[model samples]
Target chain A: MFFKIIVFIIIGIAGGFIGGMGMGGGTLLIPLLILFTQTDQHLAQAVNLIAFIPMSAVALIIHIRNKLVEFRHVLITALPAVTASVLASLLSKRVEGADLSLYFGIFLMCLGVYQLVSAIIALIKKKKSQEGKQSAENKRELSENRQD
Target chain B: MKKLLKKVVVVVCSAAVGFVNGFFGGGGGMLLVPLLEKVMKCPVKKSHATAIAIILPISIASAITYIINGYFDWTSVLSVSGGCIAGGAAGALLLKKLPTGIVAVAFALIMIGVGVKLTFF
Candidate 1:
């Protein structure tokens, strides 16, 4: 039991850290729990949701201190989101365990793909903008020499 | 009028985000970020930060439901949360040193693998 606690703590920390970073550690938490711990898929997801509350609260506090969050936005988003999430949670309960696992797996795969594609695209856009700046600078220097 | 319209848009987007997050057990940011960035015209940092805040209440809402439904494993929740708090703080410190792009890719790959395994095997 103690060993299990230790392992879970480690898992939580990792998940928390990733989640804190806004990378969605629960994304990792659900699968890892299901895979490594042989936990039921629904149980794993439940843990992820429950644990996310504190993790988000902590991160939200930090972001608040840093003035990263706007309360109006929070209110607009949280109010409805919470209501919908409750409904979703109830619906999730009705899903079969195997189907839940399958859906979660599919969700993770799609999320992963989205992350990779977006990162690569962001990198490309960054490079293009940098190149554009460089070329524009070269044009300005050339025009200045012509005026001289 | 414009302000009210934007607020309405935010509300609608947030509702969608809430549904997704609640349904999936978390992932609101995926949609929330884009909604704020593209639709609400929010700054990137603010969008991400607010998304986290938005998730807090939503998470609690779903979590309560899960709890009432007896879906939680207390030992697992306790152990993981203990680590998560500390890990979150630690991750921030290490963010720069870590290759975030690579990490994202790796995370994605793992997701696909595990997702496939769970779905079929």
Candidate 2:
């Protein structure tokens, strides 16, 4: 039992770290619990949701102190988000655990592909911008040499 | 009219974010961060911060639903939450020192690999 608790804590640390980086720790947490432990899909999901509350509350406090949170925008998005979340959570309870895990697997794959693509795109954009700056600097150096 | 359309878009998108987060039990912030950054023109850090704010309430609502439906397990919740708190602080501190693009790519690859294993095996 102690060993099992240690494993769960390690998993939580991995997920929390990702989440702390703002990359959705729950996405990784649910899968890790389901795979590494004997946790049921629903239970794993529940753990992710509950664990996030305190973790995020701490981060939110820090962000608030730093003046990073945009309160006006939060309200606009939050109302609809809350309503939809409640309905979806209720719906999830009705789904079978195996089926839910299968669906979640598919969802995770899709999100991974999307993240991969976007990250590559961003990398390419960064490279192009850097190259543009280098060429512009080279051109300036050549013009300066001609004047000298 | 354009402003009204933008508001409509934000509402529709936020609802989608909530639905995904609720059904999956977490991840609303992933969808929300981009929406805030691109659609709402928020700075990256601000979007990340605001995402936590938006997701916090939605997560609480979903968690309540899950608990009401009898999904709560005390041991797992306590253990994981404890670890999460510790690791989250470390991650936040490390964020500034890391090269985000490379980390993002590595994380994406890991997600894909794990996702494939879960789906097929």
User: How many angstroms is residue B25 displaced in model 2 relative to the true structure, after the best TM-score fit?
Assistant: 0.2
Docking verdict class for candidate 1: medium
Interface RMSD of each: 1.6, 0.9
Go through the candidates in order and give each one's C-alpha lDDT.
Answer: 0.80, 0.93
Per residue, candidate 2 scores C-alpha lDDT tens digits across B14-113 of 9999999999998788789889999999999899999999999999999999999999999999999999998898888999998878988888888888
Can you list the residue pairs that collide in candidate 1?
A12-B83, A12-B84, A13-B83, A13-B84, A17-B88, A81-B18, A85-B22, A105-B115
| Candidate 1 lDDT over residue span A48-131, tens digit each | 888777767877788899998877767667887888889988998899877888887778778878887887787778789999
Give the best candidate by TM-score: 2
True contacts kept of each: 0.85, 0.82
TM-score of chain B of 2: 0.95
Off by over 4 Å in 2: A136-148
Model 1 CA deviation exceeding 4 Å by range: A129-148, B1-12
